[model samples]
Each structure stands twice: as C-alpha cells, then as structure tokens.
Target: MPRSHPNSVTIPVGVVVRRTPGVTRWAKYAWTVTDILPGAAPADWKVLRSEGDVTEYHAATLPLTLYVPDAEAYAHELQARIPSIYTVLRPNAESGGVPWSVALVTASPYEAQDYCDSAEELVEKLPMPHGLHALIVEFVDKHYEEEAFVKRRRKNARVDQTDDGIGDARIRQTTDVYRAPRRREVAN
Candidate 1:
C-alpha cells in the first residue's frame, strides 16, 4: 500500500444466505443472509447446507474494506454486545434469477444508515468473525488517531448594525400598496 493510503485494507468476505418458505401469501420464498466467512473464496449461489425446508447458499464474495478515517464508527460498533458487519442487498429485478444480490458490505454504521434511507436496498447484520475483528482492531490501533475537538467560532462581523436585507428592496416604499395612502382605497 502507498503511504498516502496506508490506512485502507480490503479483506475477502463471503455472504452465506438462507432460503426459507415465505410466511406471506404473496411470496413463495424468503431469503436472508445467515453468516459471513472471513477470507473466503469467491462464490455464486453455491449450496453450503440444507436442512428440511431451509437451504443455505454461499451467495457472493465481497471485499470488506477498513479505513482509518472511519475508526470512530468502528469503535462505536465494537462497544456493542456483538460487533457486526452490515451487508446491503439490492433486489434483482431481471428475469429468471435470484431475488437479491450483494450490493455493499460496510463496517461503518453511518455508511450503512445511508443505505437504509433508500427504499430499494435491504440491509442485513451478521456477527463479525474473530479474524476480521482482530484485523479491524489492529487497523484501528495502528492508524486510528483521535481527532481533537475544536470549538468553532463565528466570523467577527457586526450584524445588528445594519438593515441590509430586512425589507423588500424591489418595491419602493412610496409605491408599495401596504404603505400607500388610504385616499386611493376610498377613491376606488
């Protein structure tokens, strides 16, 4: 890695999803991400396990990237009872294919929140594996520098000394109907 971008690293991650019978009447089947594998090889809907009515598949291998700038967000997640990695899945609308595809994998909660705001994408949380957790902690320890809190001061300008934008400048006071004489009203 270059010195300019030493704080960033990518780790291969596999998304394992489970398919089950849909509870609703409109849908035939339901899908959900069950687990994540650290340093897993690339795969596409390869069956991992099957039990009764449920089946698990290795959907896709995505790169889980860690960045130094987002260390604070990662720290927040680490404080939780179970630190997790968020996966965003986009609906697949193309004919004759799986119902969903892996869109993004994010460690930062803020970034994951942005995806949640959109209606088109679905977000799933999976427990962070020990190996990935160590990598995140090591990366945070090496490059996570606590930024100092600096109080922002407003610009030094006299605001109460002027009426620059108080009223409508386009309408002259002498020609304004609100300020015009009542004689014009009586004459109408």
Candidate 2:
C-alpha cells in the first residue's frame, strides 16, 4: 500500500534573504510574518522533509538575511555556510550600498512538495517586509508566477505537461554526470 497524507500539492520552492547595511545579522529574526505585518500568520514555516527521524521541525529559510559591511566578505561567508548559486549586484552610480539587499535562494527537495505549498501559501497570504517584498515575495508569489515552470514535451501530448519541480522534468529520465569530490574544491 502507498503512503497517505491529508493535504498534498506539488510546489517547487526555495528561500530568499534580503541584506541591508548597518542592520544586525540578527535582524533576520525580526523577519517573522508577525514582525513584518500585524495579523500575519506565524513564522513557523515547515520545509516538509524528513530530517533524520523527526517528522516535523521548525523549518524555514532559517536565517533570511545577513548584513555585512563588505560584499566580498559576505559572499565568502555565504559560500561557506550554504553553497548553491549566488549573484552579487554591486552598488554603482545608479545604485548605492547605503542600502543593499542580498538574496540567498535554494531549492527544497521534491518529497516536501506538499509542505512547500503550505509554507508558500502562508507567506503569500501574509504581507512581507517593505522593499524586501518584491525580491523575496516572488518566491511565494502566486497567480503571476507558477510554483514551477511547465513546458510542453510534445504538441500532441495527452495531458499538456507535468512539472517534476526540480528545474526540468526531462531530468526524470536523464543520467547525472558526476565528478568525484575534490579536496581543492573544498579548500575554496
């Protein structure tokens, strides 16, 4: 027999963090939906994955943002803690570092799709921190954004297309090209 769950929906999601100058790294703690908006839902966002033996844990982006005086230093710090992908849009004549934001984005594993949906819905239902909303909100923003992108594999296909939720559905039957972990790569 298959496993049973009361509420289940597929969603591809990740966490977004906003960094600002002079703000304490601890400012992320105040990012709770409550801190950002009154009457907002609780900050307890569950990631919906099994971490060891625990069924449920206080799962969220963990810390949404970390303010650093220097971008390169911050990048090094972030690269060390959670390595995924990162983008650094430097402040320039058009932009200033007096106020800047850093977004740390990551994909949640597929098995937690349902919980991902619920967590996303909760964030959407609540208002986000000012200015930070646009950057971070898009992660949970529905209607305009699809939880995951779906492409047509075939024009004459029977059921449109399905979203496997991990970047591309074509990966479902694809082979991963793996290179052995290197010590030098870790030193970086």
**What are the models' TM-scores?**
0.77, 0.17
Candidate 1: pairs in clash? none
In order, candidate lDDTs are 0.84, 0.30
Off by over 4 Å in 2: 1-42, 45-53, 60-63, 66-68, 77-188
Q: Name the candidate that leads on lDDT.
A: 1
Clashes of 2: 1
TM-score result, candidate 1 = 0.77
Per-residue CA lDDT of model 2 for 100-165, tens digit only, reads 222222222221233345432222112233344343333233222223667747567557566443
* Residue 66 shift from truth in candidate 1, angstroms: 1.0
Off by over 4 Å in 1: 1-4, 157-188
lDDT of 1: 0.84
Q: Which pairs clash inside model 2? A: 19-102
Write candidate 1's Cα lDDT for 57-123 as tens digits. Answer: 9999998888777888888888789999999999987735589988888788888999999999989
